[model samples]
Target: MNKQQTPITFWGIGAQKAGTSWLYYNLSKTPGFSIPPVKEFHYFDRDTKYPSPNILSITKTRDRVFSITYLIKAVRAILSSVFRGNFHNIGFFLKWYFSNYNDNWYLSIFNRYSGSKGEITPSYSMLSKDDISKMYNLSPDAKLIFMLRNPVDRAWSHFRHIKKRIKGFKLEDVQEKEIIEFIQSEGQELRSNYLRTIENFTSVFPKEQILVGFYDAIIDSPEQLLEEVVQFITIDEQSNKEFNQKSDEEDLPTKEIVNKSIELDCPPEILNLLKEKYHDMILELANQYGGYFNKWYLETYGKNSVNENNRLQNTIHLN
Candidate 1:
């Protein structure tokens, strides 16, 4: 196999605060696996007029008005190249696009840090339909890996993390009540209508080409889960000990801490509303992945499972 023909890419389309960073770390450590240095290369989020290296500085502009033309052009170009004319044209276009940008710089980071197969940004999950279609046009054979978590918890975690970055921002600066209200109001719509993201991803890629792992599963069995991932990507397990080393300790908010943070930010009424809106989704996720979380916690800390359960109960008050 040609070195450049590797098809593995991690598409972390984040329910932010879903232990994506932890997964990235573990995946990178796996022998013969190559993960990019910049974990979230928000490439497919928007288009801007900046040069290659400054791609990071280009803010993600979510305006539909500006994107319509690009979207149309991308769709038309993809359809035309896929069915109408020479297939070589598609390869030419991909090379041209990558050559114009600092993909070399991006790829260099991967080469320096990676092994055999390469993983790109998690931000690929947030890609617009047009952007994803373009990705399909560029590399239809690329393998996709997605990690999902409880959306409500994910949103809450995202809010708390973002609060720290805004200057002069008290958590109060952005009304926690209002934030929860917005999330609750939008919960069903957001959860059910992922047509533009996850649904689209599944549509274009075959089931065999994609791996949908839950964050809960990854947290529970890092070694086994990672070994499965390594096998899936066809990387050798015996060549590396990095996967067995202790993972870097970067503390993330527990369910208790997240809820406390939420309580600190808003009133009881808003909190209740947020809970009500998120309740069904949370229950669904718990029913699906809670077992994994329980097993993972039990294995990782043994008797501390009680403490973890207490913390989770205190947060969601799930019986």
Candidate 2:
């Protein structure tokens, strides 16, 4: 297909920290698949705030000498356009950034590939309704995939990730009582609300167009998960791809180690609260989408996961 006609065949709508990086790496390696060089383009979910035009506009009010310099640059740009087919200077890094957020610019990234093209931007799950509709309008045929983790587990992992990024941060240095409080405030609650997020997406796209898989299952059976994904996207089956672990995941802290480091293991109270909050949502998913998610929840979290338990039945609280 030509550049203009090319369509993205798949999308990894992320629950952040839910194996999106691993998925991106594996899919990029698969035969006949083209993934962007960068993982998170943030084009759809983030505002494209390139300041080039604003800078030029503000520069218009500068003194005579500066005005002359601007005029000279404009003239030079014109000459460069005519002689070298370059309308802008090579030093304009924002030009490249500006292009990244545009539809044509995104499409051009996959121009050389005729096979399945996709991107993994986990934050796309947080897109507003209008933006999601815009995405659907652009690529109605795209198969969307969302990988979910137990909300409590996902929230804890997210907190740990943020913890690592902050300067001088240490899990052991933090007070035991404050760990749950900090994670609650810092965690991405919107991401943890899988049912709502999926509902919003499914409202815009048909049920068959969206695939929701759990992180536990993906980690446990990645090859089988990927095989199902390949079938869903109708891409040519890949025989040589390894999906059980991230290609670059070596030397990373193990999940057990990470969990052990957290005191109280995310506070049983908060964990129970999260379970109660998401109980109805999970039940709806179980009833409507089948046992994949429900069964996974039961198997992963045990009896404490659902509201059917007497203690959790009265713990429902809305955001």
Candidate 3:
């Protein structure tokens, strides 16, 4: 493979079950950008094992069942690049897929586009402080984005997502006790712990370089929120120029929610526990972000006790 220019990288390190997927979808469609065709690289936060490219291992990319059909599409993209006389940077990923993970291997994923490019991987949010420090050392100037959601709601959405996608279970058949256990599950707690994610990243990256957004913005004021993030990412002079990836984006989504979770039953007891479990997180986010999080704490917390249904939970089953 011929030498290529290193791409400028950015991130959407996230609070999963938040609006990260939505951010990824819209960013890919927006012009002047080139993102990996695969949404989640699962690189920085993954165990260094760097599992093989078999369907089971690759399934972690989207946190959904692996489909052989997608593999076919990937091969087709590679072959098309060759026919166009541009090999892209298949070497790093091809090797990374079958071999060990390296920092260079991760950088090469974004090498296809010399213009500003990045991977909007939500799993990166769960990375350890040491791992995040490694991430900071990599692209010191890389603009990082984090979208916060109400921890309680994020937990329920995340639980439903995994239960439906990975476990192949129906929400109707799930028990309240199971929901409670899942809320406290290690994976769920780690991702929902926005406080940890922020502290780790801010300790490394300058505060101005990291943009924190709210998932509520996507629902309430999507365009404005998206515009803010876009400007922050492209503020660097190199990212100012426009690029043409229209052909690549033809098959991708334009305006839609990705990985929309199915509504699941949140028993009153489970809801009570979840609100209790994430109470501190809610108060912290409210103190930090203020707008929606402030509303989340006020609307969800009642003076009586954990059992008392707050205004929002009473109106809608939060779980």
Candidate 4:
């Protein structure tokens, strides 16, 4: 195996459901780029039990658990065996066992999985300050890309999506109001506060290393935006064409589903209050982000610019 040089990792650090899956799918298809087999590794959230396929043994040896020097040597051996395709090598098996030691171990896993480039969990957007710093420290040169969307729409879509997953799961401890409140709060936080994620990351890495793309731009002209992404990652021409062609229509909930979700998740009074509270804030955010909300609305609703006469006619019809 060729000695590994610096590897590029894409961190989704997300506005979930904001075209992240689509981005991952298309980028993974790029011939030279090695999108991880599992898109959302989510290693930072919590350590999961190792799969039998990957885990060599459960025997608790002091070497596996205690000694830092022993652990590093064991990891190096395991990595070598795995990469060499020598499954029977005990050292390789042992390295696989200790792969969860640090974020660097995860980066090594990416190197093994793909020859050219690798990306990690998009959920890194929700990481705390310390985690982000640790990620930077582990791979200082790793490029970061953040995908952002209209907060109201993104949040509503996310809520409906998550609610479907836990449809029959009872939550006796948490009331519907609380759930709605949680959703509303999270939505607002993403809109208002998540910009700080950029600030925090930029503090550690230079401006050029970090790229931010709006969801509206991606939807409007994916080819162009994807080309920019390809340039940033230094992907080849053939891979660029493949990545551009892989755009698929993202599945979104219908208006009826969104309304139904709001009804089911919020009390009428609270819903009305939230609508009133968020209307101005949403518009302000829209304006701040270069009318991102308006662009999204027009694209989604297919409304041409309304003239004064049309507005007057609509008012008369309402009366």
Candidate 5:
């Protein structure tokens, strides 16, 4: 348990499913960067309490379940506990769940190497301003990277991710009405309230310390994005290696699902509702960042300035 003398150099604070896994995988392989064996530290996102095994929110739960490897480990721990006449298995679970509270424990994860270190935990986006402030206290100079996608698309992906995780649930069998209700529900919608999350991080961290990227751009030109990230983090560009990770592949939240073969089951009505809800925010973000959001809106929904303005005007009138 050694305390880190240096602040964390980089972070991928996220809009999940937006190329974070690809970023983490590539950064881990890159030179002059020290990435821990586990990609998501869950340090800033969690507290020092026993994590509930009966977590209802799919997004809040860890992706892994009782896998063959996990089963073997559990059996070994149980057998060891019985022989030792002690509850070692319970201790193991506690340590794994609450490992982040120990500052030295978190630091030790990256202490094996001498280089710039960081973590890529998508759930950190849901953190409160107070939590982010605490994170700043831990690493005041940490550079934050946020990758965003079209909110509708991001939410849809998130829904699909949750759907895939439910045991005995086939996504195709899910009803459109039920899915739409779930999407519109507060629990799910909060994850895509990007405006609030971004503000929370930027309000504490200087705008220059935060780097916002787009998922479409990452797909369209990963090499450019890779180089930009490298330069931003001050990683040695001389050791630049090609991004071998399949950036094109969907970064599913759960390991149970491997591919994006499942056709998105979101109803057009639901999409329209989301667009109506988020269009103004989306437009503002696109305008502010000059990134892919505006272009994506144009391509997906077509150009309609008059209609959009009218929609805003109607909202004003209604208010």
Candidate 6:
């Protein structure tokens, strides 16, 4: 298909820290798949803010120049796009960051690839209803990929990630109270809410279009999970003229470690707190989406994890 006619194949709306990087890396290396060099385009859910905003994307230009992190990200995106060795994409990147990014401009980023194309932006899970509606208007038929982790496990992992970013970050140096407050915060609450993600997307798209995967599968059957995703895309885009055929049997794919988290085991007390706080959310998740998630609930909250967490809390609280 030509560039203008090419439709977006899929989107990875994610629960952050849930194997998105690994998925992106595998897809980038795999033949026949054409993804943008920059993994998180943040198109559907970016701040879209700059000092001087465009009229069409009204209020997109945020007053973010004052923040160091925003400046770093802005510079990084432009630099990555420039150094990608594709001259045409520079124009696309310029328009993406500076002007109103219409659907065609967004398509220009991936249409360069003859095979299947899409992007992964985990933050899109938290997109507002208006933004998600905008996404629907652009590519209603696009497949969505959402990966979930155990609520407590995912929250703890995300907390640890924040701490780990500091210089010489250590599990021992982190205080228990800090972890508790972090878990209770609105941000973490939103990230771990698989049900909200389900409800949000289903508001605009059908159930079959969304693929809810498990973090458990990533550890247990990485190759199978990757293949399943590839198959999912291929089924939709089979008619694309330039799509490449799957490789031979001997060319088996090898999994690469991408953004592996530090192995700081969750304290039982913290685990108990997480479980207690997110009990309903987790239970609802288990009820709605079974498989390893169900087993995870039984094995985690209902089994030894409960006793272990309570014991740790008893030592700390003495209540």
Candidate lDDT (C-alpha), each: 0.48, 0.59, 0.67, 0.53, 0.62, 0.68
| Tens-digit lDDT track of model 2 for 231-285 | 6666444522332233244422222211122222455666676677666666665
lDDT of 1 by residue, 43-136 (tens): 5553642111224443433432266764575456556777967465455333323333443433433334345545445455555566677666
For every candidate, C-alpha RMSD to the true structure in Å: 12.4, 10.2, 8.2, 10.9, 9.5, 8.5
Candidate scoring better on lDDT of 4 and 6 = 6
TM-score between model 6 and native: 0.77
Q: For each candidate, what TM-score against the reference?
A: 0.56, 0.66, 0.75, 0.59, 0.70, 0.77
lDDT by residue (tens digit), candidate 6, 85-158: 76665665565555445566776666566666799887777776677888777777778888777777888888
Candidate 5, residue 7: lDDT: 45
Q: For candidate 5, write residues 198-300 as lDDT tens digits.
A: 7788889887877776676555666556656766776444433322233334332222222342345667777787778778777775555433655656655
| Candidate 1: stretches off by over 4 Å | 1-10, 48-99, 102-114, 166-174, 177-196, 235-267, 279-319
Two-way TM-score contest, 4 vs 5, winner: 5
lDDT (Cα) of model 6? 0.68
Cα lDDT of model 4 by residue, 1-319, tens digit: 1223555555666656566666676566554676654566565543223211222232345445686866786677667768878664553245445544454566566556553465645456655666677767666666677776655556655555556566564445457676567565643354334456666677676666676665655556555555566556654566555544554443222111111232234445544554554455444434444345445434433443322122111001000
Relative to the unseen true structure, what is the C-alpha lDDT of residue 195 in candidate 3, on a scale of 0 to 100? 79
lDDT, candidate 3, 28-121, per-residue tens = 7666677776777776756743221223243234443155776675576666667776554465335434443467666656654655588877
- Between candidates 1 and 5, which one is better according to lDDT? 5
User: Each model's number of backbone clashes?
Assistant: 3, 0, 0, 2, 0, 6
Ranking by lDDT: 6, 3, 5, 2, 4, 1
Best by lDDT: 6
Off by over 4 Å in 3: 1-6, 48-100, 166-169, 236-255, 302-319
Off by over 4 Å in 4: 1-5, 45-98, 114-116, 166-176, 184-192, 235-319
TM-score: model 3 vs. ground truth? 0.75
The better candidate by TM-score, 2 or 3, is: 3
